[model samples]
Target chain A: MKLLTLNFLTCAIKTCKTNPASFPLHPRDAELEIQEADLNLTFLKNILPRLMWEELRVISSELGLPELPATPPAPADLVEPSNTPLDTAEVTLAEGGAEAQEVEETPSQTAKDLHRILLETCIQEGKLVCGSCGHEYAVKEGVANFLLPGHLV
Target chain B: MLPTPSTSHVCFDRVYEPAEDSYLLLDTLSSPSETSFLQDRFKHANSSPPLVLEVGVGSGVVLAFVAANTQSIFGRQDTLTLGTDINSFACRAASQTVRDAIKERENGRSVFLDVVNGDLGSAIRPHSIDVFIFNPPYVPAELPDLSRHEYYNTIAEGKKATSFQQDSYLLQLSYAGGEDGMVVTNRMLEQVPEILSDERGVAYVLLCAQNKPEVVKARIRDWGSGWNAETVGSSGNKAGWEKLVIVRIWKSAD
Candidate 1:
């Protein structure tokens, strides 16, 4: 699962739904896989406002990745026209141009870091422990199993 | 705001690619009537964005289409899209599909897409979902065909299996509804009230003739006094035409 997905997930145990700690299920022994995807600035900027920034900061720290800013960057700053050219090499490469030189121009640091956490990082194996119930949901082959036992369901 | 038809190429063989039933559900969601109904609700809703979820999001095409249309067509931004699928490959494919769908939108709306690998909607917080969509495995099949071992074995052997054999494996998980094609859908229906937002929760479910849409609607209405069910859209011929219908359910104010 992508790290972005963990933001919305909470413990499924019926009794745990209302508990404050059920949310942002803590990842434990996570095995990370980084698969590079073409960064879509529009998507990154669009999704930033919806993210729980503080929750993500805590999770990112737990995963031992570079820390995200305590607060999300202003949406306008992340999507400024200047950042658009950072992906020119990708656009040209997609057009089948062999001479396209990789542009060293950097995107906003916030965009780069958010891209890494949201799109590139995949959790291949681990367990998501409920902060309240202490239930460990297994992650196998990048899929987090969220099914509860019949009684729990 | 229609979903790009290229999703089939992005979906892996094991992933449940968009099919006729999926399109029918999309049609129901994007139709002018449904869009207006949702828009009216958005206008009056409180500060929080409505949480929209799709259970069993195979290729994630349905949720992607809704997210894009909810903004581009309806001019509404207060909606967050979430999806879940039992297939691990599906979760990945869904995430990719959602990303591609909204990549070009210039709207400053906060469009959030998150996918989970879960059974039904098990990972979702109860009473948090404002709109729920489920297109379950709705084809009747023997119990053994639904086994996880059988599903993996079929995928391991590749896609060269005969049509009948293919139907018994991972593909079976997509279509094998079991016991009148309502087994999985029924399990989901039971959890609806618990998972749905108490104020104005709405659900769109896909059903075909064999599954008996009328029976399902009756069951949903019976779930509680406030629940109501109605057919929002239907496609194909009445006789043996694989007729699919989208059923909308919601709780009426007391």
Candidate 2:
């Protein structure tokens, strides 16, 4: 499973739905893998508004990944520096253009790093523990088992 | 007509084979009306791509179809797809189907999240899903005993794969809805309103004639003042039975 999946997943227990703490299932002993994929520049530029950055930061630190910025990057931070050689291609549109208006703008290192963490990283094996109940959902061969036991359900 | 995702590598003995109900979901989702509806719904300037979740992905033909045609259907290349299945075999097999189908597309790549092994949409966070879909067990047959799910979900001791009997049990989970075939569908319907995003969340559910599509739509309309359920696609009118139809449920912006 892509690490990004944790952003939208919560504890499966019915009772946990009402609890905000039930979200962002915490990973334990997670075996990580990186699978290369095509990066959508548009997605990279527009990802922050959809992301729970605080939760994502917690997840990254838990997984022992490089710590992220304390705050989410603005869309303007996702573009190449105007001084770079790539800027030659986008030089005409650099003047007074709002964020991401020019199709010619190249993605910055920050965008690539964000793309890698969210899209390329995978959790092959782990246990996702619910914060509210501490119930463990096993991740086996990249597929998490969210099936609760009869009594729990 | 869009190319159907191939399930050739899937073992039908354990997984649910693509059938009429599955095809109806594919056709309805990719139809001109649906495409236009979805595009218009998420067409805001630089809006984040919508998340598409399909419960009980079965052979993954439907999810894979949506992933491969995100540009055509969702009008966004970055639409994300996630799936869940109670049958472990289906979860594994369907993941491959989705990945392979996406790889086959030369361009316009979409993201595919992993397929979790879970019951229905229980694992999803509240108000997290933008577009949800289901082609549930609507056969009006007795549901298989789920106590054996863990055993059937995994290979027997010392075996290379699941036994023939276990395979059959897994396949049974794909259909067999128990008592008018609405047992599973009913449970899922109850979750629809809770799981969907309040802003633009929409859902597509496939129902057979026996599932009482009319009553289901009426009940959905009663979900609240803004809720609406409409049949957007159907096929096979033999014996006056709508063999299969797709009901699109959404909260209208009133």
Top candidate (lDDT): 2
Give me the TM-scores for chain A across all models, comma-separated: 0.79, 0.86
Cα RMSD over interface residues, candidate 1 = 5.1
| C-alpha TM-scores of all predictions | 0.72, 0.94
The regions of model 1 sitting more than 4 angstroms off are A2-4, A12-21, A31-61, A64-125, A140-142, A147-153, B1-5, B11-13, B44-46, B72-74, B104-112, B144-168
Which candidate leads the pack in TM-score?
2
lDDT of 1 by residue, A5-120 (tens): 78767887768877889888999999999976556555565566557788888889999998776678875665445646646856777867776665434457667778889767
Instruction: Tell me, per candidate, how large a share of the native contacts it keeps.
Output: 0.39, 0.79
Task: Estimate, for each residue in B22-135, the C-alpha lDDT of model 2 and write its tens digit.
Answer: 988989999999999999998664998799999999999999999999998987888889999999989999999999999999998888888999999999989989999999
Reference-based lDDT, each prediction = 0.75, 0.90
Clashing pairs in 1: none
lDDT of 1 by residue, B1-254 (tens): 46553485453456777888888888888888887877766544333566788998888888888776666434455466788876656777787777667665555343544577677877776677889999989887754432353244324446553344443355667778889988999989988898898987899999888899998899889987989999998886677647889999999888
Model 2: residues with Cα > 4 Å off, grouped in runs:
A83-104, B240-242
Report DockQ per prediction, comma-separated.
0.23, 0.72
Query: What's the distance in Å from true for residue A100, model 2?
Result: 18
Instruction: Name the lDDT value of residue A21 in candidate 1.
Output: 91
